[model samples]
Structures are given as C-alpha cells and as structure tokens.
Target: MLIITPQELQTDRLVNQLAKTWQEHGLDLETMLKTLREVRSEYTP
Candidate 1:
C-alpha cells in the first residue's frame, strides 16, 4: 500500500530544486541573514 500523497511528493521536489539552484549560483543561505544585517547597519541613519 502506497502511503505518500501527491502533494508531499511535489513539495519534496520543490525543496530539491531550490537546493540545486543555490548550489549552481554559489549562494549560501547561512550568510543571507548576516549579510542583510550588515548592509542595513552600513546604511542606517
């Protein structure tokens, strides 16, 4: 008996696509927040 639903399968595929995109672009999610904070601080009045 199959237990996985169509929605679950689609969601998994979407997550994989994002991970692949990040790798192809050489972008790191970990540094995203820190980079944003630094930019904001540098420009903050």
Candidate 2:
C-alpha cells in the first residue's frame, strides 16, 4: 500500500515550479545532475 501526504504534494509542486524556472534559465535537471557529478569528482581525490 502507498499513500501520498499533503506535504509531499506541496513539495512536488514546488519542485515542478523550480524545474520550470531552471529551464527558463537554460538549465535542466540532467545538466544540473551532470554538473554536480563532475564537481563532486573534482573534490573526491
């Protein structure tokens, strides 16, 4: 069984809005993820 809470719903909406805003700024989730991985690698040793 699975259930979704009101807080989760709100967070989902917020994430959607953020993703839209990021797209408008010329960055999508994939690009952000790839950048994060690259940055982490640089610091990892």
Candidate 3:
C-alpha cells in the first residue's frame, strides 16, 4: 500500500490502522488528507 508516512501524519493512528486492515473499506480520512495535500504540492519545492 501507499504508506508515505511522517510529516506529522498520524491521522487517528492511520484511521485505526486502516480500520483493522479492511472490510467495506469506505475511506474518508479527511478526504485522504485533501488528496495527500494535492499530491504533495507537486513535490515540495
């Protein structure tokens, strides 16, 4: 999985560890952190 962690991204412990792995994995972790901050702002300067 795409687990690019750090930068203070604890996101409720990664949404309770991805809600215990899976099962109707309806995601919405803050809208996937605003689409991973707009795809990391095109790779930070």
TM-scores of all predicted structures = 0.47, 0.67, 0.22
Q: How do the residues 1-45 of candidate 3 rate in per-residue lDDT, one tens digit apiece?
A: 788765756898886778766434665667678889999999999
Q: What TM-score does model 2 achieve against the real structure?
A: 0.67
Q: How many pairs of residues collide in each model?
A: 0, 0, 0
> Where is model 3 more than 4 Å wrong at Cα?
1-23, 29-31
lDDT of 1 by residue, 1-45 (tens): 879754557879997888889778887777666899999999999
Q: Which stretches of candidate 1 lie over 4 Å from their true place?
A: 1-8, 33-45
Task: List clashing residue pairs in candidate 1.
Answer: none
Let me know the TM-score candidate 3 reaches against the reference structure: 0.22
Local distance difference test, each candidate? 0.82, 0.92, 0.74
lDDT of 1: 0.82
At residue 32, what lDDT does model 3 achieve? Answer: 70
